[model samples]
Target: MKINKKIACFILSTALIFTPFLVNIHSYAETTSIDNEEDKREQEERERQEEQRRQKERDYYVAVEMYSDFPKLKNDTQNTLTVQIKNTGGSHLEKSKIKVSALPGEISLTGGSSTTQNIGTIYVGNQTSVNYEVQVSKDAKTGTYPITFEFTGNYGTSVENYKAYSYSKTFYLNITKTEKEKDKSQYKPFLIQNIKHPAIINKGDVADLTFSIKNPNDKPMSSIKVSVSPDEGIVNQTQGVFVENNFPANGEKTFNVKLFAQDKAEKKNYSIKLTVEPTNPTEQTDSKSSEDSNETPKILPTSTQYTGIFYNAPDKDEVDGVKNPQIIISSYSYGGTYVEPNQQFPLTMSFVNTSSQKVLRNIKISLSAEEGTFIAVNSSNSFYIDSMSPNSSVTKTINFVTKPDATTKTVAMTIDYTYEDTKGTALTAKDSISIPVMQKTLLSIDDVAQPQDVMEGEPVNISLNFYNLGKTKISNLKMVASGDFTVQGENSYFVGNLEPGKNDSFSISAMPNDPNKISGVIDFTYEKLDGSIETAQKKFNFTLNPISPMPDNNNMDDIQPPKHDNKIIYIGVGIAVVIIIGIILKKRHNKRKKSQELDLDE
Candidate 1:
């Protein structure tokens, strides 16, 4: 009964303690449930707020526009086009794409941005624009060019939200005939108009040039401007002139251009160009086209169609004993012909011209020879012809003379002159004549007055006679002597204009400083009237004797002669006597010595 009471009390105590603990545990569990529910509610509210914010922040909108000039174009004409895109969105549009397409014509996207940022979210009023350029076809018929812009973007759900926006604009492209396509017969023709002058123009001369503008096309022309460009030494009446009316179809316009040539102008032909300009309304039109009826005119050259005359002769050659020759050259007109050296010939040049221009006035011809040669005309003549038309000509005669000592060979003769045509344009012609030179007989130094012996410091006289048996004249004569002698007279003389078979006499005096060392040849050279040179030479010898003194005979008789003669005679005799005595003494001495030796032996 005691153990039962103890157990019951223990059980009651343990139950009492455990009952509070259980209650506290139940309360704690309730608190934990409330916290968990609060946490779940908070999580749900945050998620809802996040979803609402995302829906407000994320949005997509797109637009397109055309950017180009001449968008509303005409048919058969090219036009450039560009399309722009704008994204009216709140959030970045991912995988967003825009495509520009055209109907009926070729289209291309001139490079532009295709990026998420490029098509990104736009704050309410913010916009993004892209450009796509396209070229319209030239041959497209009259129609509307529909350009469509399509934009593709994304929305919230995993499934792609596609909001497609498209807009199109029509270009009223009309086909009309262009200016180039108008009446083909309205095309203008090509023309050439040119002017030419004489080869040699005198100063202060009024020269005329013919201007012909040829129409090469089949159409009639009008409203033309003809312009002239005159260089230095030339003056034109006007810079340009206009023809008010129309030109006949396939016809030429003829006019005369007067060039007031200045005296300062050199002696050569001058060239000028005539330009023609046609009138047109469109400034962009090609002036060279047939439609530009007022096109530049063409220049017709008459000189190219005409043939000029030429003359020539042979050149001269250097030779001995040759007389100067004569050559003649005649020309109907002017050209590049020139005379060569030592040439002998009569030449006539032919002239021709395709145009009907008449050459009037006398052609004044002049002749000139080389420096060493001479030219003489018969009566100082000048060539003259009444009148020469195109392709017609006449000849004039000329004469050239050569000197006696002139080099014999072909020589050149140049003939130059000027004439005026009916148009007042001065023309020139040149010709050459070759003349042959004949060989002339030359006179040598047949005799000379020279001394064979000469004393030092004595003057010696030398005389020479020169004769020319040739047909030409002689001039500019000179003579010189080389030695130990000083020339006291004139060393050079001018024998002007010696005729054929003429002789020139001259004297020279020389004083030699040292006659012993003197000996050499004398050279003579002279100029002949026919532009030639002659040379001759001669040799001389001289001797000089040395001086001596006379002897004296006054003191010859005052000197003695006997003593020296006798002394010489005695000396010779003594020498012979001494030789004989020596021989006799030698014999005696030998006998005595022999006697003495014999006595000693006994």
Candidate 2:
């Protein structure tokens, strides 16, 4: 039986330890199966959406075809071109067109030949055609040239659709070279295209001028140069008037010219002319021996001019109209130049708005004292003024108090204010005013009195007179005493506000339990006229007497009566009841026994 019990206990312990691990494995397996199934379903849905998108594009796209009638032609010979528009897709093309044009310099189109032709609505599986006459340039090289036909219009399956579509097709034609020589200026390799200038130039101000040049031909031009000159009273800065030495072609080039207007020049429109030319001409010789190759290449000089306006400085009247409002401190007044510690008083100050054009609105004045040394009484730190007209002034008053421990010195009252202009733009301004504060805390305790004889653990009352001998009022005055003496009840007392040369009295209860001599500091803390708080202390010393024991009294009156107890009374009552019952039973038994004896005797 013992062996069977041991085996059962071991099995139970093993099962309890591994049960949580087995449950965790089963839960992980279930979660993995759910995540894998969800991923497979999402991927299948994405593939279905992608296939649908590709099918929609195939149903909406439009296609067309175009070509030239002659595959080959001589230079300057006229040729005809044809275009075929087809609606090969499922939807109908509501409107479309084919516009033909030859590339400049390479080929040209006849004047009377139609270049752009419109093809009306063409339904699915329908087509349209257009014809154009074009000519290859006489100077065209022996190569193929492209003529572009642009197709642009709206198309849809229904008449209500407004979708726009644009496409183009270029047809190439083989051109045979012509024997005619091209004019040098007709297809100039270099040209001065344009000039850019600033819109306005104030007197005594500098202007930036830009000249743009480009090569109109496919071949490059070497030794390009640019020159410029300004009209009267306008001169260029201390830089070269002519820019030179560049091999420019096909691409555009820009050069900047810095010009300054004379201070005394008339405030009117002025102009500057710019010229561009190549410093060298085309040459086939390996070495130059002619004037066209050796001389500076002014290939085909081109000139143009640009104009701008100038203005003088504005006057004071105009300046005022653009300026903002200005705020400043005008004046201030206080009850006294100096203050007693922790005395509260009113301070009045004035402010002025110096703007000449606009009215100030939503004006607010905020006040702050030196940190830790002063505070605003009643939290009167901010005041509001609805509005102040231009060159107007306003005054405000606020209560301030100084801290009790603040030193006698001058301090600043910071005034920060914000206002809005007539246009509703907000602006902030700041100013400060200095004020002298007298911290002569002439407060002291006098007329100290206490019992000459005292004992340990005995209660004592000490009395003293307090006075404020400063030059200002001390607000919220309080007195406290502490040290070797144990204070009973309240250790501090309020003496209210004490004006200059004033006195007050109060009493404090204390007990001397340890020190042989009574000694402690009497602290006087109060608020000043500027709302600051501080403390001043006075030390005090007094002798303590030894403890004396009184004689004992032993009288009978002291041992009079025992106190009543409810539990004792209840116990006495129960005992008396038991005795009474016993007596009654005894009486009954005796009477019965006597009767029996009598019967026996009979």
Candidate 3:
């Protein structure tokens, strides 16, 4: 019995000790299994996050917002529009393009800018914007119109090359009917009916002139002042001043103008300009006289010149009542029937004598110019016409040139002739003619091609297109570039000529040295028909992107050159020279010792 109990106790003790050890082993195994499961979960989470990041990189998202000035667009009216684009993607985009499309039939776009625009580069979470001016047709219907905007571009995270992406969005616009209004200041209140003057007046004579003025507006104008003045050749008798107190509405008033003709006044048509103004226009009284001499007048100036005549009037024969000389211009023409400013052109004048009893003799035609503005190029100032029979006609040719800066203007000229009448009376008759000068040609620059990416320290080619936007031809056109950059190629390009509405292009290579806002001007010079030069300029601006620096990767083993020791080298050279002198002296001393020993032996 005792033995069985001992055995039981020993087995129980062993079981207790071993049972804890087995439990520990089981707990260890369980912990390893749990750790492995946690590692697997963590790995799956990392892979999922990588996949999500890759998906985001491949996606391109953009948020768009449109703004306009009017809530409803009106026909025949101009409106401003703004477009805002926000990048919501994970990559950077470059060279983005946007254009307005899918417009309704009632809509049209016109402005100084183009319809399509380049939005440049947009980084992730950044935005870009554009502005445009929109116009609608005058006869557009009132309704809802759809406007589509399309975006096309490439991204930086492409696999092989820049991947192209295209997106389109449509926005609606409400259209309404609206009429454009004109400015009230554009309406004129007065009208000039007729101006009558003597057809012939001699030098140092007073010219009696009559002019009629009518109020064309509904309201009556008071305190009216009239100013009639000559541009050249004559002066006003009363200092070119006239005043009227009240001008009746819808009624005409006639005033007489007296001007003093100068002694040096050539036979020319003078320009008389009339100016009118109203003072105290609202106040009116019936007691005001037709001459309204009580009120102060307002002064206004006319925009253009009025034509008048200056000449020596022909004497009338008392018995026959026949005028001695009568000269009239039958016809006139410029070369090729056209005249341009700065162009020397032939002006042919045909004169007719429409007199019955007068026989013309000793006829000499004299020409005078309006100084500094017009020049007589090829004709004599005093031309002879020989003689003209009664009721006969003759023709003469002269060449004249207008000023280079002359616009569409009338150049005044004088024609004076001396002749003897049939009754042996010497008479002088003067007449004037105006030549119309037109602007020949104008050069305009458009479609200038600047580099899309103007980077600092890089060469870029720039091109400019020139067009002859005028009615005539432009000659000797040249272009030169200036500002901010060094011209890599030829600085100037010579284009021979450009016809009306013709186009030509020139190119130049340039490089910017510094990172700054690069601005430049292209100077365009052209020649007119009369060999005069004119200049026009077009301006351009762009930002220069700086070049990226190379990364630094250095190592310690790169041996540097030995430091120069000029002082040590100089000292070593001096020591070597001294040792050579000492060796020569020692050799001479030993030779002398040998010579002394030989003498002792002798």
Candidate 4:
């Protein structure tokens, strides 16, 4: 009861959390109205985001949305069917081709069964439509019939990781009887590839043989079994395996089987019996069986093939049934981790023959790039090796220069080589290695505008200007200001992605406590193309004198009065007084003498 309650609670919580998102999506699709260009743009962006979120788990998917132009057709009338293809995958589909096939006679396509119309390219969340002139025979009934559509193409964001894929789906169409018109199909799928293998078996040896098994059906077939039985004196060491996935529709996969021969086995040719069958398969219809549900085993058609060609015993000296020799780039090195445009660097590579039982000779190696972005420096692109023993390796170094105008940031160099086996049979193989070519990141910082005499404990505005002057863009660009100061607002800013030849700037207000020079570093960091972190720093320094608070009138740090000499001041004052007294006495004496002379005269 507790478990059941917990499960119910969990379900309720999940529904509650997701209900709003569902409602928002529904409302946006059904109710939202685009009143202006901005609204339309926002709708497009939201749709793109929603689609990307929905396809997060799928790498690439191309689906078919088919419809017919003429729904109601009369006898001896012409009709057209329209095939629409949509790319809902994570990547772009290029060089796409769609082919339609149906049961012959009653209803026939204007183009023969071999016809395939080119749809070009379809971007993510985009659709491409093509019209096929479908014709129906006048004797056909008016019921619905199944028609299979096959799509094949390459998909990826870049050339290095592009992969080939094919999708086949069956859609029904209701077409009335009409006059017949047809053109023979010149389209042929690349199939029936019998990769030649040296299937020779010496006595007392185990041999592993490989074969390409293709699914000829329009739908995926599961539990495909390929059995190989050897003649007398030989043992089939191949064990049956449970396949986890179905054979891709209209595609092929390689399978391997091991065989062992007894020491006393006859040297004559032995007929090997081959059998193939599918346990359960997907069928095209209006309804489909649940792929994840248990399937009941049903009797299906099986093919039994016997090839009289048998394993041959090598001559008395040679060891047959040996695995093919493969040359691989075990380890490679260059002058630096990244190469710049028009820069010369030495590329050293070690080639190893990985086969244990085979020694390869006459190795002709040639290194070339698809775009010819790399050119050898004073050397040829091809090299020759006399021979290499089993499990042996040889290292060679070559100086090369990158093209000055190479557009790709990362270039793939292909190594095409051919070596001869012990029997002098020449085998050719191709290998590739990726090299990172980055344009020098030139982050130019406009002269940082310094603040006027800064005062401690006061906020000062500091701004920086920078530009990306390089040819490549940078990602996750972050700017940080750190020093002996307090930033008023955000000290760190994320610029996200910066495009080439783009300019940007940021500002921050910082308060310093130090009385001396206050210094701060504005560091800009971003991820390089090689996934390495690089940083460019701009240092800003200013003299910040402590701003004394308004004199507290009692604080000891305030200015004090100056001392004076009191003795000198006293002497000067006494002299001034004596001179005034002498002047007064002289005046009194002159007045007295004048009065006595006047009395004597009377």
Per-residue lDDT tens digits of candidate 3, residues 373-460?
5667865656787678876889888787776766555667777877777676777777677766767667778855656554445455
Which of 1 and 4 is the better model by lDDT? Answer: 4
Candidate 4 lDDT over residue span 258-348, tens digit each: 6777666754556666666554433221112546455442333555655432343433443465666667776678777678888898999
- Per-model C-alpha RMSD: 57.6, 44.8, 28.1, 37.6
Tens-digit lDDT track of model 2 for 107-217: 666877566777878777887877666777766644334466787666554556456656675554555433333234333535565566654555566778777777665
lDDT of 1 at 445: 56
Better of 1 and 3 by lDDT: 3
Among these predicted structures, which one has the highest TM-score?
Answer: 4
TM-score between model 3 and native: 0.32
Clashing pairs in 4: none
In candidate 4, stretches whose alpha carbon ends up further than 4 angstroms from where it belongs are 1-339, 350-364, 386-393, 408-410, 416-436, 452-458, 512-517, 544-602
Which runs of model 2 end up more than 4 angstroms from their true locations?
1-322, 443-602
For all candidates, the clash counts are 60, 24, 1, 0
Which of the two, 1 or 2, has more lDDT? 2
